[model samples]
Target chain A: MPLYYEKKHQVQFYEVDITSQLTLSSLLNLVIAASGEHLEEIGVSSEELISRHLGWVVTQYHMSIKKMPEKGQTIYIKTAAMAYNRYFCYRSYWLYNEDHEELIEINSVWIMLDLNTRKMVPSDPEIMLKTGAEEIRRPQKFPRIKLPKEQLVADKSYFVEYFNIDENEHVSNAHYFDWMISSLPLSFIKSNHIKSLDIKYEHEILYHDSPKSYVHFNQENNRSYHKLANGNLTAAECVIQW
Target chain B: MPLYYEKKHQVQFYEVDITSQLTLSSLLNLVIAASGEHLEEIGVSSEELISRHLGWVVTQYHMSIKKMPEKGQTIYIKTAAMAYNRYFCYRSYWLYNEDHEELIEINSVWIMLDLNTRKMVPSDPEIMLKTGAEEIRRPQKFPRIKLPKEQLVADKSYFVEYFNIDENEHVSNAHYFDWMISSLPLSFIKSNHIKSLDIKYEHEILYHDSPKSYVHFNQENNRSYHKLANGNLTAAECVIQW
Candidate 1:
């Protein structure tokens, strides 16, 4: 069994939206931080991996929300590295209120990458052993995100700012959530809440890359589809159920 | 003497820059959040103040930094409402490392505004009394931010997005620091550290306002001047010593 790690966090004012509920992007950051701490506790920190020119790059995420945490709410974040294949690693994260009621559940897939070439590489056996993840022959299956039937409209563009770049020298994955949600109408955003989200990262976005967000909302299914791209190079695609 | 409040915080990855040091904007958010908690404890919380159709608005800030905290560092943030006159209130914030060594100091001026009218109003005696702040006849003084000696150039333009607006229904003041810093060259930002900063807010920027960041750098004084403007209207002006 993989080792489990948990930490308590208080949502700050800067992490919330106008309605006082935590933003999706901030929620992702909190979960990722918890995972980072978990790895560090297991003696397989990101910095140690970076020193060997090997880094973990997220490929996909599937999240379900019962309710978003609000400002000033103290919640517990729990994470565990469940299993790993030759090239892919699977992890799970959970957010719970003080009462121990689950608020959000997220499962993510990551791949080890050679930083020098930015190419996918096999997970090192020594590092994988440190995480206490079980070696699996088969990869975990996630729901596939279908492309929008209608042509998506490029509604907004975002310039990669200096602050957006993370220690990994790439735009943090959480920013993609912000870009996707910003493409929707303010009225719709204020009235609707996210039920579930599935996102897949295709190409990595770098500094100064001006990416445009393409969006399509289906009224019949109450679903929204989003694509972040720089010209023809798509960086990420996401589907949100409202 | 006014009541003071202090809290300890562990810097998280999201709060740091590429170099692992806390970003100036994040530092401001930490300080402001500390003040919010302090006011809440004093029985003059922002919610209570807003219910009466009144709100506290920042007018000016002067800050001096000895060093910026890094990721994984535990630091203490302390704040107090120093004094208040008829129309202006003074507050001070200090950030200290685990050893209690001072890292950053900020002095700010605020005004009570009638939310309905958006007009400046006198200090509410009952609320001010709750803060344990001494009423004074004279307003506290802050450094004057003079206009740039050279013609400022509009280096970058930023569109106010949905997330930029805070609960006050205006763009958060901390974001202005981001816009100003982003106006500088990445090379310069990476090489230099901020020594001091003085900023004065003239008007509030709202959603969808595409404001331009204008900057002027003086080599002799190692000072940079920044102005955020929406067409002919100026939003904020700042000077930073490196």
Candidate 2:
């Protein structure tokens, strides 16, 4: 069985932004969806995991973008399981245009959680074997993202709505990026392009939680840090480099 | 060329709400997308209209929903142009589950606009002839939606974001429904099911415009009326029956 899987998708109208380019949040969603499809093809489907009282939760993500696709364009997304340690698994995703030119590359880390106990678990031997991944082919190690503790540069409050929740019954991870990027000035987004992003999922935002986003920008490094919070609880922290 | 066109789609995770059922706004988007594809198949595509300095603009809509599809389900959307008058073209859409069970029925009215002049135009002879519609098969006329003109019960402001805009360089018609529905209380939406909707598009909301939505619920009729506005200009009005 092949370790890598690829899928083609036609960009829908709703996925495009005002500039007619794909939004960052939607791009992440496409990657996650493709990863799920790949998992299903390998026999470790979400249904199978649920039946075992287990689930995969994303922990860290680092993505670099060369170009953003446009509406009606057909793009290919390729994903593969790179490696797995005792408690975490590594994966990589690549996006290509119709001409086969690579447009984006992403590396992600995930951990298995025991749903019944609500705690982290070691990688299951049978599940890891099904992925067909070679430890020797693992990608370079991902660095931990660091966000400076400082006063907020900008902030916004968002009420979690029905559409924001996923089948997992919590706020989808991609939306945290949405709230972070949206907090930036419109002019800055329209004039500049995002080069790279690093995000760390710290806490899960449940339904009915109105989380406030705090942003801090580092002009010297051209980077931005974001924290999503509900009262004293921090839901997630992210850093973006443009 | 057949007058009816059918397309199948797998419901994605983002299209579902907290209940795992398709959101009403997403359902409307599916219908509108199917209508666009039908037009493309008949050679009256958006490109053709733009080349002729014209565009298709929706004016009114009436939809009735019997059931909402769940995530991961494959649904078939069927659409057709029913009839056309001197200035208006009527269309109908139906959604069916994988088992061929009908779930939704929608009727809509559209008008041709002179893009250069920014005004309504008569239906072009060539365009109408290409649709292959028969006047004898027209559906029942849609009733005008009545909304109370009294004081507003709830209101909220929303800034038009990059993702809200479409290829036309303005807010897409379907997003108006999204904003209107999202304005409702989350608890109410989670517990209740939407049965029918009536909407009328009055004005266009442009980029960078922060429009506010005013809502009034009628306890006696079990209906809600909404008005979207950008300061002095009214963007749209909708009446939803649950």
Q: Which one wins on TM-score? A: 1
Relative to the unseen true structure, what is the C-alpha lDDT of residue B124 in candidate 2, on a scale of 0 to 100? 79
lDDT of 1 by residue, B1-242 (tens): 78999999999999987778899889989998999999998888888988998888898999999999999999999999889999999999999999999999999999999989989999888877877889999877789899664679888998887778776557888888888888888788888999999999988898788999999999999999999998889999999999
lDDT of 1 by residue, A124-164 (tens): 88878888899999989999988774679989988888888
Q: What is the C-alpha lDDT profile of model 2 across B56-145, one tens digit per residue? A: 888888889898888889999999888887788888899999889999888889889999999999877788788876544343478787
The CA root-mean-square deviation of candidate 1, after full C-alpha superposition on the true structure, stands at 1.5
Clash totals, every prediction: 0, 0
Give the Å error, residue B138, model 2. 11
Record all residue pairs in model 2 with backbone atoms less than 3 Å apart, i.e. clashing.
none
Overlapping backbone residue pairs in candidate 1 total: 0
Tens digit of per-residue lDDT, candidate 2, span A37-117: 889998889988999899999998888989888887999999998788778888899999999999999998889999999
Q: Can you tell me which runs of candidate 1 are displaced by over 4 Å?
A: none
Q: After superposition, how far is residue B209 of candidate 2 from its true place, in Å?
A: 3.1
Q: Which is the leading candidate under DockQ?
A: 1
